[model samples]
Target chain A: MEQILANGLYLGAQYALIALGLTLIFSLMNVLNFAHGQMYVFGGFVTYTVVAQWGLPFVLGLIASAIILAVMGALIEVFLFRPVIRKSKRDESTMLLAAGIAFFLDAVILLLFGEKQRGVPKIVNGVFNWDMRIIMPYDRILILALAIAMIAGFIALMQYTKAGRAMRALAQDRVAAQLMGVDVDRYSMIGFALGAMLAGLVGGLLVTITGINLGMGGPTSIKAFMMIMIGGAGVISGAIAGGFILGMMESVGLTLLAAYGDITYLVIFASLMVFLAFRPQGLMGKPWG
Target chain B: MTKTYAVLAAFLLTIFVLVPVTISATGRWDLYYTLTSVALLSIGAAGVWLTFYIGRINIGQGAYALMGGYVSAVLMTQAGFSFWATLPLAGIFCAAISVLIGLPILRLRGVYFAMITLVLTEVTRLTALALSITNGAKGITSIPLPGELSIFGLTLIPDFSTMDSPKPAFYLLAVTLMVLTYLVLWRIVNSRLGHLCRSLQQNEELSASIGVNTAYLRVLAYAISSFFGGLAGAVFVAISQSIYPSSFAVTDSVNFMLYCFVGGLGYVGGPILGTFLLYFGWDLLSAAKEYQLLIYSSAMIALMLVLPNGVLSLFDRKGRRK
Candidate 1:
């Protein structure tokens, strides 16, 4: 039980960070950016290339991932999403645009990073075993701590900053924010950049533990979607809650259903469908919000 | 009306007669496979297009396709049912299953609906993997070719296994199904039900307030869409004579939607044109080898950016006027 709890908590922290970026982008643009996972994988590769291949410091690699992803996010927002959203009559046009970008990024990641799984040298070594009841690597513990710190820092940034206030306003109502001098386009770009940066940060942080690969992007995106849906789409607290819940489910399910062999995800996904049917608004979100 | 019928006849003649003759004359039997694939894929895309018409981005059509393939495969192999008998049964099974799934999720808003449907394909794949009945990972293979079809004392279609080459027969089957699917789609779009669906797309709340049975219409459209997807999948299985859990995957689902987008969401024929162009375009880009995806995706992005309304919009003078 303690082992499952520890595992869930560690998984929850990282999962919450992934969900945070996706929810942020969704709330801001209503775009449901499919490329978000590709962006996350790109971040992992960036960190891998910097720290593992270039022999740079891990901290520097993390920063570089954040910076690079932020810029890419901003450019995509300004050039692809913004213009398409402006010109297209239907809202779902952006969905196509987003899926296209996802394909584009997947291809780019394959060409640049190759298909092999990659990992960096562990930042810390040593297994923390408590009475043989719970065992976890020191690296996982550090990653959990950093992930929590990043989440806390993000909450602080959103709650206390001026840019954050403007973004919140834009998310709440684009027309109202524009009327109130929010500079909608600029804030939208900033929000996208910030959202993408969070994905990158999580990717870079987790690279030491789970490693990264080209094929992880689609599954990551689907997992992030499940998280957001469980919490309530576009709700920060809900995303975090959903993340933890899913993490707990995964940890417990994997352990308990070990005898069944690979039916855990099938059960989880089926239950999620049933859950959504009953509560479309999710646990914390307003209807259609 | 006469001119329209004439033009339609001409188009049918071109596809049914001229194309095959040209292929035969050129000794390019390989084109049959590509064209057959396009025809089958477009049937699935047509289903996706139907959901889009009712204001849903259906990323789950592949689930129904996979289900349809499995259904046909199982019926043919285990039950000893003829392939002709299993085809419509597969589609009906998928439609019924979709009704069960769509009742709840169809009520959600657009993005939520899309997201849920996106996971559904993966769920179906996982289910296929976990189920003992689907033959686990090995999948059902080496299925017999479609047998003969007869009504009363007359043989309507000969057995595929006895043919000199089954390519033409398979191509004709796929194209005939494709035409039937689109004709049904076109008829629906022009019918009162289609108009009601369009109203649902425009404003579900307003439509509900004005006495439209929004729930029924949504479910009906979804069932029909899945029916098409199932039919396509059944045809695809017959062509390949095999079924796999990964046969119709998430990428295929996404591609179905992409076909609708690339062809033109507003038109009935959009998916048909879109599948033809995109499939052949990918084949053409095979020369690029490793860069094929990169180039294909870049082209997709560029196309979306440049022609947001899709390629069909280029010929839509009325759309331009608006």
Candidate 2:
């Protein structure tokens, strides 16, 4: 049980990183970006290139990847979301456009990375064991610490920053935000860029834990979407709650199903379906005003 | 869907009729399975279309069809039941599962719904992969077709099971199931229930205000869609003589949605037309094929940018005039 909880928390951290981006987009744009998984994968690939291929310093590689993805996120928003939001295309447009971007990204990754899975060497090596009693990797511990710090930083930024207030303004109403001199469009671009950076950081962390490839992007995106949905799309709190719940579920389920030699993605799917049915906005999503 | 259906119907008819005759005449034919594959896929896509028309994008439809295929095969191969009994059982099982799933999935909107159903689809596939009854990822293989059914010494089964070849099967598939689908959709579209779904789609609040149980209606649509999905799966199982998880994945569900969108959402012909163009391009752009997804993505982006209403609406000036 202790192992399960610990594993779940570790897994949950990964989900929180992924879901944060998804939740941010959902809250702001009312559009769920399907290409989110690709953004995360791109992060992993960037980290791999820097650390694995170019033999750059690990910290620089991670920071560089996040910054690069932030720019890419801005570009994606300009090319895709702007047109849909401007034209009042609403949710349908988002669905179609997001899927298109994901498809394009999936192909791009395939072209760039080939089909083989690639993994980056752990940023911090060795395990922290209490005299071989409670064994866990130093790398994973770093990830958990990083995840907690990131979430805390995010909460601080959201609550205290001027940029955060502007983001909230835009989230409530683009027209109202613009009228209030909030520069709604600019802030949204910032949010997209910021969200992408978050995804990249998560991606980099993920590659240290497991190999990533183009094929994993879509599935991972789905899981992230599920987390955001359960967490409540427009709420930061929801993202955190949903991510941890999903992480715990996944870890526990995977471990239990090991006796059967495989965990049924269908069961997880079934659980997600039940979750959707009961709470359309998700578990932590703020009710409609 | 109309355009997709028309194009698919024409293309399959051509391939079905021409490919075999051409092969017999010239004798260098290699792609014997083209028509069979196209027809089978179209059938599956048509089932996909049914869900989209109801204003819900069901990515899990492929899973339901896969379920139908597996259940049908399992019953016939393992349980020693006839195809007729297993076929109905497949449809029922699919409907039951969809209803069970619909109870929850219909609650979600936009990406959540799409993602959840997609996960369900992968789950269904994984369940099949994990189940001993499904042969545990090795897949249910070598399913036997009914040889003949004679009541008063009359043969009902095709002499050699017409599904074996791409041509006769295409005609049989296109004319029979396609026509049935067309009629069913036409009837539904012209009915009051169809109008309600469209109304709900246009404005959920207004539809709810008018006292329509929008939730119930959505579930109904989902169940109906699942029925066809199972039916298509049964036929596919018959044609392929095997069932595997690869045939139905989360990707198929997403592809199904794209096909419906391209065909034109909420229209009788959208899925048919969408499936047609998708398969046509899928056939035409077989080079390296990995780039096919990119090509598909580019096309979708172009379409969304150019015409959000879909290509079908382009030629439907008459419908617009109405």
Candidate 3:
């Protein structure tokens, strides 16, 4: 039971980070980046290269991966997403573009890294026993701690910084924000970059906990998208709550059902149908006016 | 429009007549098989196009396809049913499942619905992997070849083992199915229901205020889409003689959506053209080996940006001129 809780919390941290990044982009940009998972996958590979293959310190590799992916995020936004943001309808065109980027990244990753799963060595190798039977690894704790710290830092940044305020303003009302002298374009870049950076950080952290592979992006992206839906689209805090909900459900389902743990996703999907039918706005999301 | 369709029908008829002759004469069964797969995929893509017409993204068609494959495979392997019998049953099964799920979730519009459906495919895949009936990861293999279609053993179509390659008959069957699928779509788009569906796409609120049952229309469109997906999957299983959980992944669902986008979402015939081009185009990229995906994705991005209406629009513009 204790193991289940620990595993759930750890998984929840990764899901929370992924959901936070995805929802941040959705809130600010009003577009879903289907390639977000590819970015996360790339981040994992980068961390694996830096820390595992290159024999660098784990912390340095994490920071490097985050910075590199943030920059790539900015470039992708400006080059791929920005030019087409004004074209046709936002949903269809942007979706196609994001899917293109996703496929492109997947191919690029496959080309660069091949099809092997890579793992990073542990930053600190020790297990702490809370009780006689309950054991926790230092790396797992580090992942959880880093996840919370990064999320806290992100929230602080969004709450305190000038760029963050501009982002919040733009998300609230685009035309009004523009009227009030907020540079929509620049803030969009910043928001996208920051979101990608969070994905990268999470990717790196997840690699340390679980190995990274080429096919991880597609499923990861879907799960993160689900978290956003359950938490309420465009609601930041909702992403966190949704993440924990999914994580707990998965862990508990695995513990109780064992062989039938795969039903967790089906149950979530069915409940999502029910939730959308009855309360489409989700837990933290305000009712759509 | 009649002249264009007449010409297209003649062209399709020419291929239908010539393909078998050429394959048997030259022994290029691979070409016939590829064309057959394209037909099957196009049939599935056409279903997606219907949902697209109704202004909903049907990213979960893969789930239906997988379900259809399982239904057909199970019926064939265990129940000793003929493939022809399983085909309609697959479509009905998928359509029923879609209506069950579609009624509740179809109310959520845009990305919300798309996201949920996206998760639905993954869930279905996992379910297939875990289920006993699906054979649990190893998948049902050596699924018997479809039997002869006959009334009282008249043998209208030869059995799979008796055929030289099964490609010619499969191609003809797939083409017949493809033609039927599009005919339904074309008829739907021209009928009153199709107009109602198009109206929902344009302005759901206005349609709803005017007493159009928007929910019913959405569910109907979705159910039809899944039916087509299931039909295609049934055909696909017959061609491959097997079914695996991994056969239809979430990526294929994404690619199906892409097929519609690249084919031209404005017309019923778009996905048919899109699926053929993409399947063949991706095959052509095999020479690049590792860089194939990178180049393919780049081409997709460029194509969407430059020709948002799809490759068909190039012909659409030309056809409009004269």
Candidate 4:
């Protein structure tokens, strides 16, 4: 039970980071950014190239990933999503553009990073064994700490910063925010960049533990979607809650259903569908928000 | 109406007669496979288009397609049913499944609906992998070719195995199914049901207040849409004589929606044209080799950016006006 709780907490931290970025984008632009996972993978690749290939410090690699992804997210928002959203009458038009960007990023990653799984050297060595009950690697403990710190830092930024307040207002009501002197386009771009940066940070953090690969992008996006759905779409607190709940479900499901092979995910996804059917607003979100 | 008939005749002649003859004369037998795939994919895209018609972003058509393929495959290989008999059964099964799935999820907002449907494909794929009847990861293979079809002692279609090459037969089957799917789609779009669906699309709350059975229309449209996906999948399995859990995946689901978007959601024939162009355009970009996907995706983004209404909008002088 202790082992399961530890595992779930670790998984929940990383999963919440991924969900936060996606929900951020969704709330700000009302564009369900399909390319968010690709951005995450790109971040992992960036970190891999920096720390693994270039022999740079892991901290430097993490910073590089954040900066690069933030820039890419900003560019994508300004060039691709903004114009498409402006011209198209229907809001869903951005989905096609987002999916296209996903394909584009996937192709770019394939060409640049290749198809092999990539990992950075562990920052810390040895295992953290506690009474033979809670066994986790030192690297995993460090990653969990970093992930929590990042999440806290993100929360602080959103709660206190002027840019964060502007973004929150934009997310709450775009037209109202615009009327109140919020530069809608600039804040939207910033929100997207911040969201993408969170995905990058999580990617970089998790690379040491799970490794990264080209194929992980789509599944990551789907998993993130599940998290956001569970938490209530576009709600920060809900995203975190959804993340922990999913993490717990996965950890418990995998441990208990070991004899049943790989049916844990199947069950989780099935139950998620059923759950969403009953509570479309999720546990914390407003209806149709 | 006469002009419309004439145009339809010319279009049919081009696809059914001229294209085949040209391919044969040019000795481009490989083109048959490509064209058949386009037809099959467009059939799925038509279903996506239908969901779009009712103001929903359906990213789960791939689930129904995979289900349809498995249904046909299981029945034909395990139950000793002919492929012809399994085709409609697959479609009906998919429709029934969609009704169950659509009832709850269809009520969500558009983005939520899209996200849920996106996960549905992966769920279906995982289910296929876990289920014993789907043959797990190895998938069902070496299924027999479609057998002969007859009605009242008259043979309508011969067994595929008896032919020198089943390519033409498969192509014809796929194209015929594509045409029939579109005709049904066209008919639905023009009917009173279609108008009610449109009202649901425009404003669900308003439509419900104005006496539209909004829930029923949404579920019905979704079912019909999934039925098209199933038919496409069944035909595809027939062509390949195999079924796999990953046969119709998330990418295919996204592409179905992309077809509707790229073709023009406002027009009935949009997905067909979009599939043809995008499929062929990707094939044409194969010359780029390693950069094919990069170029194709870039072009896709640029297309969406510049032609947000889709390629069909290029021919429309006044743009899409409801």
Candidate 1's clash total is 0
For candidate 2, what is the recovered fraction of reference interface contacts? 0.62
lDDT by residue for model 4 (A156-214), tens: 99899999899989989999999999999999999999999999988889888789999
Q: On residues B264-319, what C-alpha lDDT tens digit does candidate 3 reach at each position?
A: 88877888788888889898899988788898899988887787667777887897
What's the CA RMSD for each of the models?
Answer: 1.3, 3.5, 2.0, 1.4
The segments of candidate 2 whose C-alpha lies over 4 angstroms from its true place after superposition are A84-90, A131-133, A264-267, A270-277, B1-32, B146-157, B161-167, B288-290, B317-322
TM-score of predicted chain B versus true chain B for each candidate: 0.97, 0.83, 0.95, 0.97
lDDT of 3 by residue, A63-135 (tens): 9989999999899888877877765443576787889999999998898888898887778899978875668
True lDDT of residue A31, candidate 1: 88
Error of 3 at B285 (Å): 1.0
Looking at candidate 1 chain A, the ten consecutive residues that score lowest on lDDT are A87-96
**Model 2 Cα lDDT, one tens digit per residue, B240-267:** 7888977777777777777766776646
TM-score computed on alpha carbons, candidate 4: 0.98
The residue-by-residue lDDT of candidate 4 on B59-84, one tens digit each, is 99999999999999999999999988
Give the TM-score (0 to 1) of chain B in model 4. Answer: 0.97
lDDT per residue (tens digit) for residues A1-289 in model 2:
7777888899898899889888787777777777889989988898888889999987887898899999999998888778766653335656777888888888888887777889987778898876654567999989899888898898788879999888887877778888889977788889998888998899888788887787888778878877877777778888899899999988888878778667645566666666666677777666531
Candidate lDDT values, in order: 0.92, 0.76, 0.86, 0.92
Give chain A TM for each model in order: 0.98, 0.93, 0.96, 0.98
Q: What is the number of residue pairs that collide in model 3? A: 0
